[model samples]
Target chain A: MMDSLAAVLYLILFPGFVFLLVFGLFCEWVDRKVYARLQNRVGPPLFQPFADLIKLLGKEDIIPKNVDSILFQYTPLIAFAAVMTPIIFIPIWSATALFPLQGDLIIALYLLSIPALALFVIGWSSVSLYPLLGGFRAATMLFGYEVPFILACLSCGIIAGSWRISDITAYLEMYPASMLIVIPGFVIALLALEAKLERTPFDIPQAETEIVGGVLTEYSGKKLAVMRLMDDIRMVVGSSLIAAVFLGGFIVSYGSISWAGTDLTNVINFLLYIAKSLMIVFLLAVIRTLFARIRIDQMLDFSWKYLAMGGIFQLFIAVMYIGILHG
Target chain B: MDLLKWARMKSPWICHFNTGGCNACDIEVVAVLTPRFDVERFGVLLKGSPRHADVLVVTGPVTQQSEARLKRVYEQMAEPKFVLAVGVCTCSGGVFHGCYNARGGVDTVIPVDVYIGGCPPRPSEIIDGVVHVLNKIAGGGLAEKSSVNEGQAVQ
Candidate 1:
């Protein structure tokens, strides 16, 4: 009964959350397409990521003779499930989410963190020197990116006057201009998330060529497949969270779905959430094509120096916003 | 066009070996995959292990220290593999050609099929050279036309 209830709520939070479950392929497709065009070369058809996933899945699971069987098998699911948990707490539209409990911002923030912990576990449990280094890099990255991300979230909370996501939307409704004011804050938050996502210009922790897919090097077959999908869903969830928090979550009531005079506002909200998430995913992919991965020092310097500076300045702006509005 | 289509579909997987050159070419080789110049669309991909590769893309001027790693990678690659010496440093060891640490031209270590002939050839030219190797594999111009050169290139 609880499982069924959760299913209905998941459907309610965003009609398109399932779409994000498949979003990694979309990001992959976008990266391939954009990169191809950048070189004046023809890019792959948009469905390339889907093709790759199927191929990877169909591959035989190969375990090295000396490997730890249990950790090797379970690591990918941990990565996927840990990342997916945050999706349940994030509101897609006004007063809507997979679980719709209040204080969701707190819940969502903590849930968003588990994937990093899981990644470290995977890296360490594999018992390889390269992944161990990659895992350490992942831990270092967590320390560098999370502070600025939390501050950016706090600035939004300051603007909205509550830790609740629903309240953030309501504050935006009361003063739609609050959306415009949070621009710098939103950008810093997005970059910090990008760094966490480990896209190029910030992919120092898992340099594939140098470390052989980093923490994922020994992961193969079903395990590797799940981990890859987790990455895709992570992008989806991250993008959706950004939209819910800053881009007017579920504010648009696109033609309603009604049953017996009760409007399924939840369903409408879901579509809105998906649309917003896809836009962010597309922008990320397009940006990915144009940039190369930066060195480790450069990545750390970028987050600590520019991205962090932007977050601090934006926090200052948020303070001035409260002064002007309430004072 | 038929020949080009076949060449495109069977684009050989490239294995990169650093023979002790500075990391500039190494970075450019990787830059080939960034959103700007995706080589994967052409069916060219990098293989981490040499055993699975069809072509060996050698960078650097073949320093004595790196020579052992390079030779190991070359020996691991399957038969009929093409050797592409990228950058002037690999072909004729540019500035570092005369350095005591430099072995001068990758050919001093392994037989080179095509020399890309640039400080660092544009990714497009790298693609060109890579595709050229595929052509030779399929019995194209150089394979059909050049000397069945038997001299050990290292000498």
Candidate 2:
């Protein structure tokens, strides 16, 4: 059991968790910088994420006597680890992943959802009724966002003619339009991610006004730190997947800083991937900074009526592409 | 480090109360959570309980019924708390002061730490006032600045 646990730990945390931390830090750096620029204010240093993790780790963890101690203690850890599982399988350079399993993407997506569900549970199990209300709101938000999200992803999968991500990537080269065919669908998908990942505008459930830090009111110390870290990584992994699926990995390469012909576009493609993901992640953050939360009813209306309309248009465009290909 | 520390010192946990003003100020206050002015980045959090809060932000003039609830919430808060009398109503009951129920601004009942002096001060300005109030709290100077009507102060 120990060895099996160790093996699972190696696959989940060793490379996966470490990579997520580094990527999260980088994405946060870009996000803060862009947000500052957007508002014409100087932002924090690029190493701010590193500083925050250190600071939060050092702060005393405050526990509310009123809280359900068991759920309160474990939820953040579950969330921290759960979101990292998806990153291990996302290809940064090629179709190769360290732990490429059958239906890994599907598992990753579902497991990726667990952390948030745990958050909802944490809120429910807590003593305060306010957090319970926030938890209900979070569950409501999950329902509203997932409809558009599932539609967007399914449309892309249908267009690519594969559910397996690696197979989908393999088919990319066979078509001239390639990842661009999924671009419109990817946009709506990114917005759903913005909500699911609990970024701004869609952050009503956790709105400080209604729920008083929403789900995190009772959390403190290393637990809160871990949860914060988890949030950062979700942004990274979600954006990275969007980039990998729609932005084409490894678009360019260079020769040790000296001029040379590029046979391997993988390095450049990696650069493109990073750049694209960073841009999307920062844009999402900007949207959060710029807008206020809409009423949940309004958001629901958007999901079913407006955002879904956009997703259908994207699906229409994608099917049109496939039709053109075979026709 | 000291200057930065001083800057940090000026930041306080603000608790807002809406007495009887038009909810415009209350709405603007809540709007801070929107991405535009993330008060969390400044370490100025919106704590849930009065016990945890250091700054008491009161918007609207004190109305007869709400004035009592306001005082109760205010009394429940631990000491070293600064009150922000926001809007014209909170300042002097504004346009509503003549009404028999209007008790002028929060100052009419509680000694306001800072008067934010706008019908609805911009969110950034409210942030500024709250930050200034934090300095006052950190200095440990919130004494018996109670109003003349502490006994008859609404409640």
lDDT digits (tens) for residues A1-327 of candidate 2 = 998887677665654666678888778777777776776655555656665565455444667667778888888878777777776666665555555676565766676677668878988877777678778878888777777776676666667776655545545544536676676777788888888887778888777766677776656547766877888888888787666556543332223322366445555555666787788887787887798888788878877887788888877887887898788
Candidate 1 wrong stretches, greater than 4 Å: A1-18, A93-95, A253-271, B1-39, B42-44, B47-155
Local accuracy by lDDT, each model: 0.71, 0.69
Instruction: List model 2 lDDT by residue over B23-64, tens digit each.
Output: 988888887655578765664556665544556788887888
- Local lDDT at A101 for model 1: 64
Tens digits of per-residue lDDT for model 1 on A13-76? 4334465545557765665566566667777766555544554454446665566778867867
What C-alpha lDDT, on a 0 to 100 scale, does residue A48 get in candidate 2?
61
TM-score of chain B of each: 0.81, 0.81
Which interface RMSD values do the candidates have, in the order shown?
7.6, 6.7
> What DockQ would candidate 1 receive versus the native complex?
0.10
